[model samples]
Target: MNTMTLWHITPAEFAVLAFAALLVGFSKTAVSGANTVSLAIFAAVLPARESTGVLLPILIVGDVLAVLTYRRHAHWPTLWRLFPAVGAGVVLGTVFLLWADDEIVRTSIGAILLLMAAVTVWRRRTAEKEEDPDEVTTRAGRAKARSYGVLGGFTTMVANAGGPVMSMYLLSAGFRKLGFLGTSAFFFLIVNVSKVPFSAGLGLIDGPSLLLDAALAVFVVPGALLGKWAVNRINQRLFEQLVIAATVVGGVQLLVR
Candidate 1:
């Protein structure tokens, strides 16, 4: 693994990785679960752990663009409530990554994505029964927040797969469009940036991965711009359905691949 070099990778593989990186930007700005497609693409084309490492930087780039666009609309109280649990979860995930082999990492990421996709579907189907946003401070609501926060951090660290998990939590908490975008942008920017040290220490992000990231990073700008133009034009129900469908397909592909 240490001897792995970019020279061995085919042109087709580079194209896929570049597309995945572009999708990362579009997902961060326009759609939530869309990057799950990128996650699957990266994992399919690269070593499971290595893909996670490379994808983190690209995700952060997208996160920065999203944050810059939505910086003023964030809801900080929710972030404060979730950070402690997220930190603990990140620690746990780091330990897991250190121990797991390639196949195990692949399967675990697939399972987590599938589970989160289910939750997203169930939440949407039962939206009528969902509680008011004002109840976020209540005991049950706080518990829910912490639980999702932990899962979000853990999944993100392990697979760059936190989008669906956080999407569900925010939707459940009733964040409208701008608030949701702003909060998610800041949350992931902080979360992904905090993870750089852990990934580096683990030797997951190295010379070849960095080179690959640099190439893929350039595609994110156009994707982000496209996303911004398209976000308001799409129907909400259609967006949710597409995200759910992409997530499920990605999860199943990971398991089989």
Candidate 2:
């Protein structure tokens, strides 16, 4: 594959990428999972494999903004428990990417997004019936964290599509809006930053890709600020609904495209 320079992107493609970058920022601050749409958009607008690389830096920028905004509300114990499993999953995903082609990457991401959406819906329904929804002390709870951690790391490594997976886990664990945003903010910031070396090693992060990222990054700032303003007005139920709806839409778009 050739290095993707700024000149390679037409004006229309730049418009689409800019919009996707804005969504990246908005998803970070308001609806944590909603950036699946941005993922799909980027994949559609660029090469599927290359898109993941381009999207990573934008996501990291959003992660920084999110940490600055919601850092105080993070759940440290939960993050600690999940990191080891997530690291393993990242390794698995990296191995998978070593040989996978563009079609495989795109299909896997689409399928993962759809499956996560379904699981989240089911989990939410079952969570209402649990005796202690907020506790993660049971054997089942520990297993669930490991499960989500692995899946989150894998999807994120492959397609930058881990947001919905973590969102599902947090919601199922009974987090409120602030806690959800804050915890996820820290989780993604740390995880996305950690992936930088791996992505660079894979030749996914390079000069031309970074050039494109530099152009699109400015749009993220305004989108994040807008998200900060909007998040305050959005109720919890509506927030969760938007996240799920975005995930489904992104999945369908990726599959059909």
Which candidate number would show the highest lDDT if scored against the true structure? 2
Question: Over 4 Å off in model 1, which ranges?
Answer: 1-3, 127-130
Q: Estimate each model's TM-score.
A: 0.93, 0.95
**Cα displacement (Å) at residue 58, model 2:** 0.6
In the range 1-257, model 1's lDDT, one tens digit per residue, is 34364557799898988888889888888887689889888877877778788899899999999998889988888888888888988998999988888788768877887888888677768777756656666888899888988988888888888887787787767676677778989999999999999999988788777887888899998888888888788776666666667677767877888
- What C-alpha lDDT do the candidate models reach, one value each? 0.82, 0.88
Best by TM-score: 2
Please, what are the lDDT tens digits per residue for candidate 2 over residues 185-219?
99999999999999999988888889889999999
